[model samples]
Target: MENSKEQVIQLNLNLIVARGPPVPTIPVPVVAAPPTITVPAFRSEKFSVPEQFDGTRSKLLEFTTQLRMKLEVNHDRFRNDAAKVIYSVSHLEESALDQVVPLVNANLAAPFSSITAFVANLEALFGDPDPRGTALHQLVTLKQGKVDFATYYSQFLRIVANLDYNEKAKIDALTEGLSEDLKDAMTYRTDRPDTVEAYATMLMTIDN
Candidate 1:
């Protein structure tokens, strides 16, 4: 039963702009930490690519030496013996390529326990254990046959250089490969030369 006017009193509701309390502040220090250098985890540069091996007996040493150097530098990639052997087999060609391709195809690592064993296998297959003896045998059995003097001489020098023959022995070995005509010409017209160089000169002169 209160008066209707009192019940209908107007609310002031004036436009009010309110600022919120400032957020909790963190103290800023004057000096900042110096920039840190980021050290690289590994060397980005890699070694030179190895020479492809074609299973030549004379070149086995070179091929193996270069491959070892390459593998050592890329040790991160070749963490295990299998990895090293597989990487080595990647640099093969011709008979060398054929010899191990099957193992790789079968997803096999080196048949032996270590990469060194794998290399030893390669050595047995492709390397000359008796280079000096082989060279001597080649010189002893060589014959000029139908080939020209230049060709025969080059072959002779290449094989002979591997041996330690003295001049007289060189002359004696050189006598083995002379063509029949060269032998006849030297025997009849030429005086035997004491030095192997003189003998070689005389034979070349007759051949030309």
Candidate 2:
């Protein structure tokens, strides 16, 4: 019996030796590096400024939109707003610069809040807020005497685009501008269009 008890004790000792000690694990935290951003360069030299400030507002806005898309920056902080404005208007006449330079110099200093704010400031100083005056005059004065329907249609649409005219006014302007023979023939049609778009479609059919 004593030999058997010593043998059991020996077995327990061997098991403990085989198992070894418990290890305490410590987790190390992982750190991520800041993101890097690169903006695409614009060839500002390729663009020329408009002859006058009358239609330059839209042109500049379009330019800024293209530039902002290319840069892919959320805010104007990457390129100084003032610098961007100057670059945009650099190709304009000296008279245009005379107006824009001082205003930009005075107003566009420091951290820009957003691209919208920057563009708004420049737009306000560049041209008339409403362009309906010139656009309406052009639409009213246009006539399709010798020009083809497609050419006349393109010019008609361009002028009417800037006007704040309703559907009725648009349809009327379109009908009135057609050649005398085409206008007469369209007026006699039983399916004379009620919508400006439908009228435009009919005109396109004539063009085709």
Candidate 3:
């Protein structure tokens, strides 16, 4: 019995020795978040032309002439073909003015009501309501200068001067939006016939 008790004590000691100390757990490596991408605000620096040659007058003339032509040619068809007229006219008008005039005019005419609606739409879309919204509000108060044919001829000159003031910034925005190869291909000068022809063709192709 003494021999058996000694053997049991030995077995218990062996069992305790078999169990070792707990191993320390390694911590999980933390993953860093990706950096956010920000698009720079459009600045018009890259396509600078001399103050005298930003082509605002030419653009305005081309726009007005094309609009006048389309109006004359399509006036009869317009009553029956509202979609086609609207498409052609809107493209020309938008290209010329950058903003839709009829809609702008409508909004301006009903300033109190339309501005509230415009503001609500902007907020819903999460659009910035600073410069663009403010500029639009200013449109309501814009008055057409007195019209004379001679004055009209000089009107483009004044627009040219204003364009010159903003040329670098305007061109920068335009060039930034263009691909590098295509950026060189686009010209702002009024001297190029090919550019003029291409624009005219684009306008004419809508109807054809």
Candidate 4:
């Protein structure tokens, strides 16, 4: 029985020796890096608030322009119509502030359904009554006498654009503003331009 026991122990020792020591595991790292997160463009920069508005017709246009630019750039900052309206109202003074008092107090019951409605009201209250008429009067007197063709063209275009004149009217006004030398050159061209853009190009070529 002792011999049988010794034989069993030796057999177990042999089985243990057959198997080698266990290997430890080490994890391999990933080759590619994680994606980078990007922040919003507007959040990176600072913007100034628009200047206060005092209900002056001449300054109204400038005020609205500044306010529009400010709101458009950081749209996330002004998410809704009420937010935009409140921001604009904050910059008002005297008469302008007085005008929006009822709307501000009304809150949810304000007449302004949209920011556009609010701006239109402001324009009606303090904007040029006869803007087109004013531009037309200026256009009739504008002459390209001493200035270069390019300069005169830029000035003429700015005034005429405000009037929304037809193609024929644009050509007529363009021709009328030409210097004496250009007017003389126009008479010689057999293949004249029909469109306003083509006409402007023809005049530029002649001027050059």
**Per-residue lDDT tens digits of candidate 4, residues 129-194?**
998997889898999998888899888886786787889889998899899999998888888777
Winner on lDDT between 1 and 3 is 1
Query: Which candidate gets the maximum lDDT versus the true structure?
Result: 4
Per-residue lDDT over 1-208 for candidate 2, one digit per residue giving the tens place of the 0 to 100 score:
9999999999999999879786768889988887877788553433333232333654664555565553344233335665554444554455546765665666655323445664565566764566778787788799988888888888887788788778899888888888887876776678867888888888778656
What is the lDDT for 58 in model 2?
A: 48
- In model 4, the runs with Cα more than 4 Å from the true position are 1-54, 58-70, 90-98, 105-111, 162-164, 201-208
lDDT score, candidate 3:
0.40
lDDT of 1 by residue, 1-208 (tens): 3565554442222212134456789999889889999996776368888889999987887788788888787787666888788777778899988987776777665545666876887898998889889997888789999887778888888788889888888888888788999988878865889887788888888888
> What TM-score goes with each of the models?
0.45, 0.52, 0.19, 0.59
Cα shift from native, residue 29, model 2 (Å): 29
Query: Which clashing pairs does model 4 show?
Result: none
lDDT of 2 at 139: 81
RMSD of 3: 21.5
What TM value does model 1 have? 0.45
Rank candidates by lDDT, best first.
Answer: 4, 1, 2, 3
